[model samples]
Target: MTKMIFLNLPVKDLATATAFYEAIGCVKNEQFSNENASSMVWSETITFQLLQHGYYQTFTTKPTADAHATSGMLIALSRDSREEVDAMVEAAARSGGQADVREPQDLGFMYLRSFADPDGHDFEPAYMDMGSVG
Candidate 1:
Protein backbone atom coordinates (compact mmCIF):
# COMPACT_ATOMS: atom_id res chain seq x y z
CA MET A 1 0.00 0.00 0.00
CA THR A 2 1.18 3.51 -0.68
CA LYS A 3 1.89 5.59 2.41
CA MET A 4 2.45 8.98 0.86
CA ILE A 5 0.55 10.90 -1.78
CA PHE A 6 2.36 12.78 -4.51
CA LEU A 7 0.74 15.22 -6.86
CA ASN A 8 2.95 15.84 -9.84
CA LEU A 9 2.40 19.11 -11.64
CA PRO A 10 4.30 20.74 -14.46
CA VAL A 11 5.24 24.38 -14.26
CA LYS A 12 6.97 26.75 -16.64
CA ASP A 13 9.24 28.19 -13.97
CA LEU A 14 10.22 26.14 -10.96
CA ALA A 15 11.37 29.08 -8.90
CA THR A 16 8.26 31.09 -9.52
CA ALA A 17 6.00 28.13 -8.84
CA THR A 18 7.87 27.33 -5.65
CA ALA A 19 7.62 30.92 -4.49
CA PHE A 20 3.94 31.08 -5.31
CA TYR A 21 3.15 28.03 -3.22
CA GLU A 22 5.48 29.20 -0.48
CA ALA A 23 3.55 32.45 -0.22
CA ILE A 24 0.44 30.39 0.40
CA GLY A 25 2.05 28.66 3.44
CA CYS A 26 3.56 25.57 1.78
CA VAL A 27 7.07 24.64 2.88
CA LYS A 28 9.65 23.15 0.58
CA ASN A 29 11.23 19.79 1.27
CA GLU A 30 14.85 20.75 0.81
CA GLN A 31 15.97 17.15 0.58
CA PHE A 32 13.77 16.61 -2.43
CA SER A 33 14.08 20.13 -3.83
CA ASN A 34 16.55 21.01 -6.57
CA GLU A 35 16.93 23.24 -9.59
CA ASN A 36 14.48 21.47 -11.84
CA ALA A 37 11.96 20.50 -9.22
CA SER A 38 10.65 21.32 -5.76
CA SER A 39 8.53 19.29 -3.39
CA MET A 40 6.03 21.48 -1.64
CA VAL A 41 4.45 19.75 1.29
CA TRP A 42 0.89 20.69 2.02
CA SER A 43 0.36 18.13 4.76
CA GLU A 44 1.32 14.64 5.87
CA THR A 45 -0.93 13.21 3.18
CA ILE A 46 -0.44 15.80 0.47
CA THR A 47 2.71 16.83 -1.35
CA PHE A 48 2.72 18.75 -4.60
CA GLN A 49 5.68 18.30 -6.88
CA LEU A 50 6.38 21.30 -9.04
CA LEU A 51 8.36 20.12 -12.03
CA GLN A 52 9.94 22.21 -14.75
CA HIS A 53 8.31 22.26 -18.15
CA GLY A 54 8.76 19.03 -20.12
CA TYR A 55 10.16 17.29 -17.04
CA TYR A 56 6.93 15.42 -16.41
CA GLN A 57 7.19 14.03 -19.91
CA THR A 58 10.06 11.87 -18.75
CA PHE A 59 7.79 10.12 -16.26
CA THR A 60 4.65 9.81 -18.36
CA THR A 61 4.00 9.24 -22.02
CA LYS A 62 0.68 11.12 -21.92
CA PRO A 63 0.72 14.64 -23.23
CA THR A 64 0.11 17.51 -20.87
CA ALA A 65 -3.36 18.99 -20.80
CA ASP A 66 -4.23 22.65 -20.88
CA ALA A 67 -5.27 23.36 -17.32
CA HIS A 68 -6.83 26.72 -18.17
CA ALA A 69 -8.65 26.20 -21.45
CA THR A 70 -9.55 22.56 -21.10
CA SER A 71 -10.66 20.08 -18.49
CA GLY A 72 -7.72 18.25 -17.06
CA MET A 73 -7.52 18.38 -13.31
CA LEU A 74 -8.63 20.45 -10.35
CA ILE A 75 -6.89 20.59 -7.01
CA ALA A 76 -8.89 21.32 -3.92
CA LEU A 77 -7.88 22.25 -0.40
CA SER A 78 -10.04 22.45 2.66
CA ARG A 79 -9.48 25.36 5.02
CA ASP A 80 -10.39 25.50 8.66
CA SER A 81 -12.40 28.66 8.36
CA ARG A 82 -13.84 31.05 5.84
CA GLU A 83 -11.11 33.53 6.70
CA GLU A 84 -8.49 30.93 5.96
CA VAL A 85 -10.09 30.14 2.62
CA ASP A 86 -10.06 33.80 1.74
CA ALA A 87 -6.44 34.14 2.78
CA MET A 88 -5.28 31.29 0.58
CA VAL A 89 -7.15 32.51 -2.48
CA GLU A 90 -5.86 36.01 -1.90
CA ALA A 91 -2.33 34.78 -1.45
CA ALA A 92 -2.51 32.95 -4.75
CA ALA A 93 -3.62 36.12 -6.50
CA ARG A 94 -0.84 38.14 -4.91
CA SER A 95 1.66 35.58 -6.15
CA GLY A 96 0.66 35.60 -9.82
CA GLY A 97 -2.45 33.41 -9.68
CA GLN A 98 -5.68 34.76 -11.08
CA ALA A 99 -9.03 34.90 -9.34
CA ASP A 100 -11.64 32.43 -10.54
CA VAL A 101 -14.20 33.52 -13.11
CA ARG A 102 -16.83 33.12 -10.40
CA GLU A 103 -16.39 35.11 -7.22
CA PRO A 104 -16.27 33.63 -3.77
CA GLN A 105 -19.60 32.61 -2.39
CA ASP A 106 -21.16 31.71 0.93
CA LEU A 107 -23.73 28.94 0.96
CA GLY A 108 -24.99 29.17 4.52
CA PHE A 109 -23.00 26.12 5.54
CA MET A 110 -19.96 26.59 3.40
CA TYR A 111 -17.78 29.16 1.74
CA LEU A 112 -15.50 28.76 -1.24
CA ARG A 113 -13.09 30.67 -3.43
CA SER A 114 -11.37 29.46 -6.54
CA PHE A 115 -8.14 30.58 -8.15
CA ALA A 116 -5.79 29.65 -10.94
CA ASP A 117 -2.12 29.13 -10.34
CA PRO A 118 0.58 30.69 -12.48
CA ASP A 119 0.45 27.60 -14.65
CA GLY A 120 -3.26 28.05 -15.03
CA HIS A 121 -3.93 25.13 -12.72
CA ASP A 122 -7.32 25.32 -11.11
CA PHE A 123 -7.55 25.22 -7.34
CA GLU A 124 -10.16 25.90 -4.74
CA PRO A 125 -10.03 26.71 -1.04
CA ALA A 126 -13.22 25.91 0.78
CA TYR A 127 -14.50 25.85 4.34
CA MET A 128 -17.35 23.77 5.66
CA ASP A 129 -18.46 24.34 9.21
CA MET A 130 -19.41 21.18 11.03
CA GLY A 131 -23.15 20.51 11.08
CA SER A 132 -23.59 22.75 8.12
CA VAL A 133 -22.83 19.92 5.75
CA GLY A 134 -24.95 16.82 5.44
Candidate 2:
Protein backbone atom coordinates (compact mmCIF):
# COMPACT_ATOMS: atom_id res chain seq x y z
CA MET A 1 0.00 0.00 0.00
CA THR A 2 1.18 3.51 -0.73
CA LYS A 3 1.64 5.81 2.19
CA MET A 4 -0.22 9.08 1.99
CA ILE A 5 0.14 12.28 3.96
CA PHE A 6 -2.69 14.54 5.01
CA LEU A 7 -1.81 17.97 6.36
CA ASN A 8 -4.70 19.45 8.25
CA LEU A 9 -4.67 23.19 8.74
CA PRO A 10 -6.95 25.59 10.60
CA VAL A 11 -8.09 28.45 8.40
CA LYS A 12 -9.99 31.60 9.16
CA ASP A 13 -11.79 31.71 5.83
CA LEU A 14 -12.33 28.45 4.06
CA ALA A 15 -13.03 29.97 0.67
CA THR A 16 -9.94 32.15 0.70
CA ALA A 17 -7.72 29.35 1.88
CA THR A 18 -9.14 26.98 -0.69
CA ALA A 19 -8.47 29.47 -3.47
CA PHE A 20 -4.92 30.03 -2.29
CA TYR A 21 -4.17 26.31 -2.35
CA GLU A 22 -5.61 26.01 -5.81
CA ALA A 23 -3.41 28.85 -7.04
CA ILE A 24 -0.35 26.92 -5.89
CA GLY A 25 -1.15 23.92 -8.07
CA CYS A 26 -3.28 21.90 -5.70
CA VAL A 27 -6.46 20.44 -7.12
CA LYS A 28 -9.63 20.28 -5.06
CA ASN A 29 -10.90 16.79 -4.32
CA GLU A 30 -14.64 17.41 -4.39
CA GLN A 31 -15.33 13.97 -2.96
CA PHE A 32 -13.76 15.10 0.30
CA SER A 33 -14.69 18.77 0.38
CA ASN A 34 -17.64 20.67 1.84
CA GLU A 35 -18.64 24.10 3.14
CA ASN A 36 -16.56 23.87 6.27
CA ALA A 37 -13.56 22.08 4.79
CA SER A 38 -11.67 21.58 1.58
CA SER A 39 -9.48 18.72 0.55
CA MET A 40 -6.69 19.94 -1.65
CA VAL A 41 -4.49 17.41 -3.37
CA TRP A 42 -0.92 18.49 -3.81
CA SER A 43 0.20 15.23 -5.28
CA GLU A 44 -0.94 11.66 -5.55
CA THR A 45 0.17 11.00 -2.00
CA ILE A 46 -0.11 14.41 -0.42
CA THR A 47 -3.34 16.18 0.51
CA PHE A 48 -4.03 19.32 2.49
CA GLN A 49 -7.18 19.46 4.55
CA LEU A 50 -8.24 23.04 5.09
CA LEU A 51 -10.75 23.30 7.87
CA GLN A 52 -12.57 26.28 9.28
CA HIS A 53 -11.44 27.26 12.75
CA GLY A 54 -14.51 25.89 14.46
CA TYR A 55 -14.37 22.64 12.58
CA TYR A 56 -10.67 22.33 13.26
CA GLN A 57 -11.24 22.75 16.97
CA THR A 58 -13.47 19.72 17.01
CA PHE A 59 -10.47 17.59 16.14
CA THR A 60 -8.19 19.03 18.84
CA THR A 61 -8.67 20.43 22.30
CA LYS A 62 -5.74 22.80 21.95
CA PRO A 63 -6.57 26.35 21.06
CA THR A 64 -5.61 27.24 17.53
CA ALA A 65 -2.48 29.34 17.39
CA ASP A 66 -2.59 32.50 15.38
CA ALA A 67 -0.38 31.56 12.49
CA HIS A 68 0.29 35.22 11.79
CA ALA A 69 1.95 35.56 15.16
CA THR A 70 3.33 32.10 15.93
CA SER A 71 4.61 29.36 13.71
CA GLY A 72 4.43 25.78 14.86
CA MET A 73 5.83 24.13 11.77
CA LEU A 74 7.25 24.67 8.32
CA ILE A 75 6.14 22.48 5.44
CA ALA A 76 8.84 21.86 2.87
CA LEU A 77 8.21 20.80 -0.70
CA SER A 78 10.84 19.51 -3.09
CA ARG A 79 11.08 20.89 -6.59
CA ASP A 80 12.89 19.60 -9.63
CA SER A 81 14.91 22.75 -10.20
CA ARG A 82 15.73 26.16 -8.75
CA GLU A 83 13.33 27.77 -11.19
CA GLU A 84 10.48 25.65 -9.94
CA VAL A 85 11.11 26.81 -6.39
CA ASP A 86 10.96 30.43 -7.48
CA ALA A 87 7.82 29.83 -9.48
CA MET A 88 5.99 28.32 -6.55
CA VAL A 89 6.83 31.30 -4.40
CA GLU A 90 5.67 33.60 -7.15
CA ALA A 91 2.41 31.79 -7.50
CA ALA A 92 1.88 31.91 -3.74
CA ALA A 93 2.45 35.67 -3.63
CA ARG A 94 0.03 36.28 -6.45
CA SER A 95 -2.58 34.20 -4.69
CA GLY A 96 -3.01 36.06 -1.37
CA GLY A 97 0.13 34.66 0.24
CA GLN A 98 3.39 36.24 1.27
CA ALA A 99 6.53 35.42 -0.71
CA ASP A 100 9.99 35.18 0.82
CA VAL A 101 9.24 35.47 4.50
CA ARG A 102 13.00 35.20 4.91
CA GLU A 103 15.98 35.49 2.63
CA PRO A 104 16.37 32.64 0.21
CA GLN A 105 19.19 30.16 0.83
CA ASP A 106 21.49 28.78 -1.83
CA LEU A 107 24.21 26.26 -1.25
CA GLY A 108 26.29 24.63 -3.93
CA PHE A 109 23.80 21.80 -4.21
CA MET A 110 20.61 23.10 -2.62
CA TYR A 111 18.35 26.11 -3.07
CA LEU A 112 15.37 27.06 -0.94
CA ARG A 113 12.82 29.84 -0.63
CA SER A 114 10.28 30.42 2.07
CA PHE A 115 6.73 31.77 2.03
CA ALA A 116 3.59 32.04 4.13
CA ASP A 117 -0.06 31.64 3.32
CA PRO A 118 -2.63 34.33 4.12
CA ASP A 119 -3.00 32.86 7.58
CA GLY A 120 0.78 32.68 7.94
CA HIS A 121 1.29 28.95 7.58
CA ASP A 122 4.91 28.69 6.54
CA PHE A 123 6.30 26.71 3.66
CA GLU A 124 9.74 26.12 2.25
CA PRO A 125 10.05 25.18 -1.37
CA ALA A 126 13.46 23.76 -2.18
CA TYR A 127 15.53 22.26 -4.95
CA MET A 128 18.60 20.10 -4.72
CA ASP A 129 20.90 18.63 -7.29
CA MET A 130 21.42 15.00 -6.37
CA GLY A 131 24.55 14.77 -8.53
CA SER A 132 26.15 17.65 -6.64
CA VAL A 133 25.55 16.16 -3.21
CA GLY A 134 28.60 14.47 -1.83
Candidate 3:
Protein backbone atom coordinates (compact mmCIF):
# COMPACT_ATOMS: atom_id res chain seq x y z
CA MET A 1 0.00 0.00 0.00
CA THR A 2 1.13 3.56 -0.64
CA LYS A 3 2.06 5.19 2.64
CA MET A 4 3.65 8.46 1.71
CA ILE A 5 2.81 11.46 -0.48
CA PHE A 6 5.28 13.77 -2.10
CA LEU A 7 4.09 17.03 -3.67
CA ASN A 8 6.87 18.32 -5.84
CA LEU A 9 6.72 21.96 -6.96
CA PRO A 10 8.89 24.61 -8.53
CA VAL A 11 9.82 27.84 -6.85
CA LYS A 12 11.76 30.93 -7.86
CA ASP A 13 13.82 31.17 -4.71
CA LEU A 14 14.58 28.31 -2.33
CA ALA A 15 15.09 30.53 0.71
CA THR A 16 11.83 32.41 0.17
CA ALA A 17 9.90 29.19 -0.28
CA THR A 18 11.44 27.77 2.87
CA ALA A 19 10.49 30.86 4.83
CA PHE A 20 6.93 30.86 3.47
CA TYR A 21 6.31 27.28 4.53
CA GLU A 22 7.90 27.89 7.89
CA ALA A 23 5.67 30.88 8.50
CA ILE A 24 2.70 28.66 7.72
CA GLY A 25 3.85 26.33 10.57
CA CYS A 26 5.64 23.60 8.63
CA VAL A 27 8.91 22.17 9.84
CA LYS A 28 11.33 21.45 7.05
CA ASN A 29 13.11 18.16 6.50
CA GLU A 30 16.77 19.14 6.69
CA GLN A 31 17.85 16.00 4.89
CA PHE A 32 16.08 17.14 1.72
CA SER A 33 16.49 20.89 2.07
CA ASN A 34 19.50 22.02 0.13
CA GLU A 35 20.71 24.17 -2.73
CA ASN A 36 18.24 22.71 -5.15
CA ALA A 37 15.18 21.74 -3.13
CA SER A 38 13.51 21.69 0.27
CA SER A 39 10.95 19.38 1.79
CA MET A 40 8.16 20.95 3.84
CA VAL A 41 6.45 18.43 6.09
CA TRP A 42 2.79 19.22 6.64
CA SER A 43 1.99 15.87 8.27
CA GLU A 44 3.23 12.33 8.65
CA THR A 45 1.78 11.49 5.26
CA ILE A 46 2.26 14.75 3.39
CA THR A 47 5.46 16.40 2.18
CA PHE A 48 5.92 19.33 -0.19
CA GLN A 49 9.10 19.45 -2.22
CA LEU A 50 9.98 22.95 -3.36
CA LEU A 51 12.61 22.77 -6.05
CA GLN A 52 14.66 25.41 -7.79
CA HIS A 53 13.58 26.13 -11.35
CA GLY A 54 16.66 24.54 -12.89
CA TYR A 55 16.43 21.49 -10.66
CA TYR A 56 12.71 20.98 -11.28
CA GLN A 57 13.25 20.86 -15.01
CA THR A 58 15.34 17.74 -14.55
CA PHE A 59 12.26 15.79 -13.53
CA THR A 60 9.37 17.16 -15.59
CA THR A 61 9.06 18.08 -19.22
CA LYS A 62 6.34 20.68 -18.77
CA PRO A 63 7.09 24.35 -18.37
CA THR A 64 7.14 25.80 -14.88
CA ALA A 65 4.34 27.98 -13.48
CA ASP A 66 4.64 31.57 -14.60
CA ALA A 67 5.33 33.72 -11.60
CA HIS A 68 3.27 36.55 -13.09
CA ALA A 69 0.37 34.43 -14.36
CA THR A 70 -2.13 31.83 -13.29
CA SER A 71 -1.08 28.37 -12.15
CA GLY A 72 -2.43 25.15 -13.55
CA MET A 73 -2.95 23.76 -10.06
CA LEU A 74 -3.96 24.91 -6.62
CA ILE A 75 -2.62 23.33 -3.42
CA ALA A 76 -5.00 22.95 -0.51
CA LEU A 77 -4.55 22.20 3.18
CA SER A 78 -7.33 21.16 5.54
CA ARG A 79 -7.47 22.89 8.87
CA ASP A 80 -9.14 21.88 12.11
CA SER A 81 -11.39 24.94 12.30
CA ARG A 82 -12.31 28.17 10.59
CA GLU A 83 -9.90 30.11 12.76
CA GLU A 84 -7.09 27.82 11.76
CA VAL A 85 -7.98 28.41 8.14
CA ASP A 86 -7.86 32.16 8.61
CA ALA A 87 -4.61 32.04 10.54
CA MET A 88 -2.87 30.05 7.84
CA VAL A 89 -4.06 32.44 5.14
CA GLU A 90 -2.98 35.44 7.16
CA ALA A 91 0.37 33.88 7.85
CA ALA A 92 0.91 33.26 4.19
CA ALA A 93 0.37 36.94 3.42
CA ARG A 94 2.74 37.99 6.16
CA SER A 95 5.38 35.78 4.65
CA GLY A 96 5.32 37.25 1.12
CA GLY A 97 2.34 35.28 -0.18
CA GLN A 98 -0.74 36.98 -1.58
CA ALA A 99 -4.39 36.25 -0.96
CA ASP A 100 -5.68 34.39 -3.96
CA VAL A 101 -9.17 35.26 -2.88
CA ARG A 102 -10.35 38.61 -1.60
CA GLU A 103 -11.79 37.12 1.59
CA PRO A 104 -12.55 33.94 3.43
CA GLN A 105 -15.92 32.37 2.86
CA ASP A 106 -18.30 31.16 5.53
CA LEU A 107 -20.70 28.61 4.12
CA GLY A 108 -22.28 27.64 7.42
CA PHE A 109 -20.56 24.29 7.45
CA MET A 110 -17.39 25.02 5.58
CA TYR A 111 -14.89 27.86 5.48
CA LEU A 112 -12.25 28.40 2.82
CA ARG A 113 -9.51 30.86 1.90
CA SER A 114 -6.97 31.01 -0.89
CA PHE A 115 -3.39 32.24 -1.10
CA ALA A 116 -0.59 32.26 -3.59
CA ASP A 117 3.10 31.88 -2.94
CA PRO A 118 5.77 34.32 -4.11
CA ASP A 119 6.15 32.37 -7.30
CA GLY A 120 2.41 32.48 -7.88
CA HIS A 121 1.60 28.89 -6.93
CA ASP A 122 -1.95 28.83 -5.66
CA PHE A 123 -3.08 27.30 -2.35
CA GLU A 124 -6.19 27.06 -0.21
CA PRO A 125 -6.98 26.29 3.38
CA ALA A 126 -10.33 24.67 4.05
CA TYR A 127 -12.23 23.64 7.15
CA MET A 128 -15.33 21.46 7.27
CA ASP A 129 -16.91 20.36 10.51
CA MET A 130 -16.79 16.58 10.57
CA GLY A 131 -20.56 16.52 10.80
CA SER A 132 -20.84 18.61 7.65
CA VAL A 133 -18.83 16.53 5.20
CA GLY A 134 -21.61 15.69 2.76
TM-score of each: 0.92, 0.98, 0.91
lDDT of 1 at 67: 73
TM-score of 3: 0.91
Best by lDDT: 2
TM-score of 1: 0.92
Question: In TM-score terms, which candidate is top?
Answer: 2
lDDT of 3 at 45: 90
Clashing pairs in 1: none
Candidate structures ordered by lDDT, highest first: 2, 1, 3
Count clashing residue pairs per candidate.
Answer: 0, 0, 0
Which regions in candidate 3 have their CA more than 4 angstroms from the true location? Answer: 100-103
For model 2, the local distance difference test gives 0.97
Overall lDDT per candidate, in order of appearance:
0.87, 0.97, 0.87
TM-score quality measure for candidate 2: 0.98
Predicted candidate 1 versus true structure: per-residue lDDT over 29-130, tens digit per residue: 999988889999999888999998788778888887767677587788999998899899889989999876467789989898899889888898889998
Query: Lowest-lDDT window of 10 residues in candidate 3?
Result: 65-74
